[model samples]
Target: MSHEIELKLALPHRALPALRRHPLVSAAQKLGNAVTLDNTYFDTPALQLKARKVALRIRRQGRRQLQTVKCAAVSSGGLSQRPEWEQDYTGAFDFGAIDQPEAAQLLARHHDALVPVFTTRFRRETRVYSPREDLRILMMIDTGEVSLHTPDGVERSAPICELELELEAGQPLDLIELAETLASDLPLMPADLSKAERGYRLFLGTPSTAVRAEPSAIDATQNAVDAFRTLAFSCVRQWQANAAGALEHTDPDSIAADFIHQLRVSQRRLRALLKLFAPALPATFVADWSVRLRENANRFGDARDLDVFHAELFAPVAPEGLADEASFSALASTVRRAREEARAHACHNLDMATQGRLLLGLTADLHRLTIDSLIQAADLRTFARLRLDRLRKRTRRLAAAAETLEPTRLHALRIGFKQLRYAVEFFAPLFPARAVRRYLEAVVVVQDTLGFLQDVDAAQQRLAAWVAADARLAPAAAFVLGWHAARYARLRRRALRESTPLLSGRKPW
Candidate 1:
């Protein structure tokens, strides 16, 4: 079996012209051949192969055919390293060359059940660049559509436009350097979803949905930088997966709303994580990405706020006479229009040339990172505990002064609580499950309480702004603001009271 290490990027068709003219592609070691590739992905009727994370595909290029099998791979920040087996196709399926025992045995047992599920027909333009004698990167620009064919002769397809950078041979940093250089000019965002995965989702007719945090695979023996990469990449995957879904959906009320909310949550998680681990990371790197993530969060802020307004605030309280049904409907319509416009603006901003470059640069930076000497030799548990303890002390101080704190200070305290909460979750897998749960339960109570108060504050501000912008909305906005004013104060008090348990709870780790 051979290992495939590559970085994949997804870009818009509009980027193709600029990318082709970029120095990295135009002045390559060799301008390689172009070909039309027709690929068909195969799976059992019950998707047995998919359950095992095994992918089987046959590709036809001109008169030649190649069959390939890819097993479960560790993928992060669009970079993947997987055990893959490939060989010439002799008009039939072949598992003889697959050395991975699990994959070979499974295919041998279920070979008869395999059937084509989806196909991708794309034209690829290839280029090879050699930055040094020992390093070579194969770059390809692919344009086409992934299609699923029905037994009734119907076909459904989604457009596919991407740039792939595969490490032909060399150190991983070489690949990072090449990608960073290319991203300096072209719009390229590191893509987490593989074409095969996309095809399977299309074939299965699965709607995109919010993705939760997967447990970090950090171990006690790992370095601090390694642990951070694992955690940060987890956040990146969550953000990218949702961003793809949000950008793909054209309808405002479709899966895009859930996707946008999840994307924002992922961004917050990443930002909090960076802040928690900033002491160990390169300062400049942390600072740059911090600003980028915050900007991204702001881009989605208006739309997400509007989403909460419609789902959580207005819909539930409409019967309390804030507005008549017709008037409420009119207001809802106005909100919906504003939301669609906001989403569109956010999407356009995300699709801009600069955003893609930023994403690619971020990916390259992550790949290029190495543990500093101070952190490399340190124990992960000790490192994690030190950060957690510092956060806990800060949180306790904030909670102790909660009632007397100004609004801005209270907000800062809430943010501290949030970071601590995220840090616990990020490292939860390394500690005892029950102990972690007990501590988290108290943290959640405090965290959610603070979140509610923040929501009320935000809603009041949003209502005031809306009414200020349009005098016609003044009456409805006034009623909404008045309805929440007393409740906000009561909730704030409760939130302060709830902080006692968290401030006093013992550390689980």
Candidate 2:
């Protein structure tokens, strides 16, 4: 058994020429001529192996056949590490080489029921990248398709074009640095999906959904620095997943708005985590990444704002009379055009190369992060309690100021509530689950109310400009604002009222 450590990157087919022209690729030694590999993955009808997160495949290269068994991969930021066993396959199935007891037993029990589930055929161009004596990486460029043969005699397939960087003798950071170098000019995006994973998705016809923030796994037994690293890595995963989704679907008109929204959420969460864990992290790391993540997330802000304006604000407003009908129709047209333009502009700037570089750089830097001696020994639960207290106090101050109903002040208070909510969510795992859930439920309500208020304020600014540009839009804008006037006032009062108990009550942490 051998542990495989590799970084996978998805390359646009159009970028193949540029990748070939890259200096690093040109300088690397070609292992041999490109070869074709045909691989068949096997599983029982019940998919017992897949259920256990194991993969069994047989590969045919020329006249030679080899069987490989891979355990579940631990992946993040496009890098994966997994244990695999490989041996010559003369004819029948073999689980003898698999040293993992659970895997071996599972495979042996279902050996007779195993059947071909999916196949991948790709031409792989392998090169040896040896920049120094102690460093070596295998750069393999693959382009082909993964196919599934259904019982009904139907074949489903998806195209595959990727670059895999297998760390042969160097640190994982070296592989990422090399990828960053290549991505500087190529349309390379770090891909967390393996061919086997892709094949399974195709076989199962799984629809892509927006990735949300996962629950915090931080425990009190760990040190503060380790807990922060764990949380930070989860944020990176969310960011990378959404960025990949946004980049994959290039048509702005048909793109899922949730992708852009969730990408921003991930960035905001990371920024919040940086503040929450600042004491345990290096000052420079926190400061630099906070700025970078904020700038990147802001690129999609216009699109998200327009989406909310169109969906939540405009869509709910109905024409009450003939005059409203005509004016509202005109306003709707303008809003649609602006929304499309914003989406297009955001999509245009969602450059794969830029995003890939940012992700890889962050991942590498995160791996290199070191804990100060003083921070390395601090109790995680104690640190979490202190941070949560600070956030709660700050939010309480903001809530008090928000009572004046000043738009700017209210917006600031909303941001404060959001940060506080995120901090609580991050530290919730360290406290009693019931108390944390109760507190979080209240935080979300206030945050949601404040968020709606902020949206109304933003919409007013945009609508005012539109109204100024066209007198016809003035009545429509008035009607829209008037429609939400009562709710906005009520929510404002409710926000202040609901936040008092949350701020004054027994804390979760």
TM-score attained by model 1 = 0.92
Give the best candidate by TM-score.
2
The candidate that wins on lDDT is: 2
Clashes of 2: 0
Per residue, candidate 2 scores C-alpha lDDT tens digits across 436-472 of 8998898888888988999999999999999999988
lDDT (Cα, 0-100) at 58 in candidate 2: 98
Summarize candidate 1's per-residue lDDT along 370-426 as a digit string, tens digits: 777888888888888888888888888887777774566567678878888899998
Q: Give all TM-scores, in the order shown.
A: 0.92, 0.97
Instruction: Kindly report the root-mean-square deviation of model 2 from the true structure over all alpha carbons.
Output: 1.4
